[model samples]
Target: MKLSVWTYEGPPHVGALRVATAMKGLHYVLHAPQGDTYADLLFTMIERRNHRPPVTYTTFQARDLGSDTANLFKTACQNAYERFQPQAMIVGASCTAELIQDDPGGMAETMGLPIPVIPLDLPSYQRKENFGADETFFQITRALARPMDKTPQITCNLIGPTALGFRHRDDITEITALLSDLGISVNVCAPYGATPQDLTRLGAAHFNVLMYPETGEAACRWMERELNLPFTKTVPIGVGATHDFVKEVATLTGVEPTLDTARLRLPWYSASVDSTYLTGKRVFLFGDGTHVATAARIARDEMGFEVAGLGCYNREMARPIRALAREYGVEALITDDYLDVEQRIETLAPELILGTQMERHIGKRLGIPCAVISAPVHVQDFPARYSPQMGIEGANVIFDTWVHPLVMGLEEHLLHMFREDFEFHDDAGASHHGHKAKPRPDPEARQPVTADEHPGTVVWLDDAERELKKVPFFVRGKARRNTESFAAEKGLSQIGIDTLYEAKAHYAR
Candidate 1:
């Protein structure tokens, strides 16, 4: 809960619903109105979940807002418990309900439900969905934990598992396979095959493998302090980190360490090749601190990109990330302000913008190519195939997202060879004409070339997809359409406005 300078770009609670539905058996009882329930679409469309998130909304209308709010909650809870009979239950409230101060946690505790009741305080006003996810998992695990003597031994809970995770299936498969080879058992995965009953078993596990930092740090620390369970501080998004994650888990579990030659080495080679081209590419990054930190490492160390900009909307875990950003000689942008983040993007003007869905809009408005590296994901990120961003597979995804956007990649070589008549410009200002080029045209001027002037002329979409335009905050559809139309007329592909921005500037008009 902190300052958020800019209004959020997407609809509220959409991604959270995507996650709730993605998990097969999870149930979420929301305490809000009908608009809040539109989140179901996130699963159906983006996450492609055929089944609904086990969620029930109080569906409180303004008419019933005062008369039966408490009764509505009780009925919702009873019906949810009766219908779903979830092993673990989450009593969560959205930003709207948080204002009324119902204290669902207090209600759930007072009701004395049979299952483990996790009261989650996810005030949309104060925090983002990622924080809710991490807290939700932690609350569930803690709700199910038992006293130490009764805890299971050598068993560990795999943390940071959530709905529609970037590459959850692959991450779990690799880690589980690795641990199984050493005869280690995963007691429970917070969101996978886990229940209130399995929670007590969490105390038995000797350690926790924190797959993602933003989501797992709290639970991992609680487990360590409360149950003496150790956690591995490994970010398993690349080849080396994957290896280290495995090794560290082995050490904590007292199991013999082994490696999968195919799984481990191929990605390292792929990343190396990717780095060869992406090296020194100006890149900017933002997300939850954990993923942002991982992206910064891969962009700078593995991919040879210059971190022209770095920032995270989450400040709770900003210290370590901030300290690391210093290596690039740039101060980490740690603020909850989206406008501030946009301002930073404008100032840094990296060749590529690496950030959330919000920054994707910022990058588009700035006319820069971008890849959504973390949350606030788009439908594109959920390609038909299972592409994970953790373990070896994650390295592969990173390689593609980073190198594919550049003109210096293998495609550029093929283009050069194909059109041997065309000349190459190696100079930094080749396209800019010594920085005197006019900034992108106004969004309002994006009219189609007149029919009288150019009758029957055909304009392809890419032709209109390159120029910068003012992106309206919170109106995603308008922003996207406006950008696509402008880029088409320029004959050049999109440009990120960030590349032109000098630091120490705010996002004013």
Candidate 2:
């Protein structure tokens, strides 16, 4: 309802498009103006699909509003069904077009196409994208899924995961194989590779595996209430969580939990290099609730890192995230406003940031190291490689994805610190680049003001300010605050280089 340059989620109809595009035999007929059709570029360009999304927009112009927009939707719906011959279709209105009150769902029912046409009563003004995907998937499942006998072997549906999701394709591949290792078979994975025919057999599965709750939890809960099918709550993202997931699955299906974790290197790699300056490193996380929560566990338990801050953008999942934040002794941020998130990141000033592409830009502006961990990512996040965020191989991919930034950042910092050294510059120029490269501007000259820069009780002397700039940019904020606090406690109004070092030593204890 509010306007912003960047949004964590699009309008409701775009989420409906995600469900439509993820499946093989589902079509989305959106009643909207031509400007609303831009969502197609998301899946085609970002996801790099060969074909366009399976969407048919009415694309009603201003002139059409004077005429009959309702008839325009009817015509588009009929044309899409005939052209695509989809097993089922979802119809809805875009946020901008909702003002006209065309009633897409009711109009689609009047047409009575040959195939099943599910009208989505998505309130665009009241909800956002994730709600749209959840409601649409639930409607389709309720219409198609029938009470059937369970599969002879133990099987479960992989619920959630849609097109344009962060690593959804590979996550399904990884999780399916992990489940197979425990003598379990996957009956169907919905809204990703599933079809209308697949939904009919959802009841045949003994249980469900809810992968991404943002898009699948509604349907999974509905099945649990209606079909008497159980579902797993553990999302296997890290080493410890994956082990817990295996145990939960074993408890559900009566299968023994014997996971083969020989390929996992995160535990060993983290501990072996414990004394190499990574232990107790502070980290900030912001993304979806699922990823933020899972990454918090991994940061604390698997890696020797301190969770400096943790939060999510989705308000619907705020309660659990807040509970987890309390466990880590931090407040949960539950808003879609990017400015607020940026301000909070500046206030926390963590050494590393794990967040969306927006935070990546924020990190660069603040001269901090950041790793993309969740959705709303850029094209670069969708690498050509088979990098997943689940199972044993996913742990390896995560280790490399997360550690490379910090390690390379440290190297860059060292190079900048010793850029003017005679022996280091002479050896570095010849070996690394074959010649001396042009000297860049000083990093300290472009440093962002720390939290202590504002008018405050303690003032930094020129020498002390210069010394603080020598510290790494990511932790410079913390260093400044620590020195200021040390000064305030000692009743010192001014600070110098000696005070900075003395404060550092005092805090070290």
Candidate 3:
């Protein structure tokens, strides 16, 4: 396996632990070494879970490896079942235990436990956290879902939400409220608050709504194949997406849903003259598959931002991300290395970054603003406030979350006008309290030349320079580069006010 100081995802077994912890009356028996137990801290410390994840690790040592590790796994399973007495149990092995070639699933089956024991055979070397979680949730559903011949009702099962997700708790509340408004009831929500018995009732719902594709797509597809239940894969993260989600649900249920447009504020916020400055603001996005795709849609359709870069670390879901990137005319960066993400951020030099905690760190170091839009999140992202990333309220949060970093239209105009004043000195730090002061580049060191700098190179006359200064400081470099390129292409060796206006018109056309 590749080694690094930090990782975007943990091993597969940790993913299983996340699922087990999220659900009620479920327990996980992990055949692992002592080191693997560190995953408990992720729930206790990072997620602030009151109870330790319902996981019982074998905690085998090097000395035990020479002996019958299989027996040790069986004993742990027996003890876990006797102690926790869960309604269901998940049996799996960690990275180190997998190398031992001991089949924990088979050993658990031999014990003849009364509860349903779902075997998770995840390849830690081949897959990651999201994939592992998906596999476990699918397997558990498959193992426990009973055959029901009941007629479909005006209800749906919400799939793929779990603990430690980015705003999942609040998103669930928002979606539930939206569905309730549409007169649709939720039959069940899996791997979040559902029990083992809840899987049997999945067929009662008219359709299924997948919140996150990474976790629920496979299970929903399985239900479709086995029980003939239709499912919607729409992620309701923006006004447009939420609208489409309601429409899709209506189409599936054959009920025309009337949307209360007044509940959504994104439409008015985006169209207001005060928000005109947000138009074409360059943005870079990198995270998991679901949030990255949702953020790209919100930035482009709802907020009017130019997506400079978009990608994810989950390779299993790369097809959709690549397709989205192609639509934006940018290449998708699909890699697990945070350094690769950092490099792309540097090359793009986006005005804002929408990404994970790692991206937040990268942006902080590079003097760029970033918002945590996906998992691998820090505690700060798990705010006490009811900040959601889905449904009507999600659109409002998205507008504020993405735009807070950008300078206001009036504020920026005033700053440019009073930049020379001592109180408004260019060296003065960012307007926000915690923001760093972005150092200004020396005029002499700038690549473009004025007539005073290089007699033979392309030159900007007095009026042209004055016009260029009116461009926002954040985008001045790009404006200068484009203008120079236009002059060079038109065979103009020197740039003047007339050439500048002509270039502007040419680009506008």
lDDT winner among the candidates? 2
Q: Distance (Å) between predicted and true CA of 456, model 1?
A: 34
- Residue 280 lDDT (model 1): 71
Scored by Cα lDDT, where does model 2 land? 0.87
True-structure lDDT of candidate 1: 0.66
lDDT of 1 by residue, 226-278 (tens): 88888889877766676787788887766777766564434455455444655
Give a tens-digit lDDT track for model 3, residues 1-509: 56898789988887788889889999999999988888667877887778888999999999998899999999999999999899999999999899998998888888999989999999999899998899999999889876576544488889999888888889889999899889898989888989888887888777889998887788989998987788897899888889899999998887887577676776676668877888888899999988999899888877888999999999987999999999999999999999999999887888889999999999877767788899999778778899998888888888788787775434665777676676565666454533566645434233566556666578877678877877765556656777888998988888898888888888778
Q: Residue 145's C-alpha lDDT in candidate 2?
A: 89
Error of 3 at 243 (Å): 0.8
Ranking by lDDT: 2, 3, 1
Model 1 off-target regions past 4 Å?
1-26, 109-112, 148-154, 181-183, 263-276, 407-509
Candidate with top TM-score is 2
Candidate 2 residue 479 C-alpha distance from true site, Å: 4.8
Model 1 clash tally, residue pairs: 24
> What is the TM-score of each predicted model, taking all chains together?
0.73, 0.91, 0.84
TM-score of 2: 0.91
The CA lDDT at 156 in model 2 is 93
lDDT of 1 at 509: 42
Write model 2 residue lDDT over 399-504, tens digit each, in one string. 8888888988888778656655873453355344445554444545534444367555566777887788678766776788889899989988778899999999
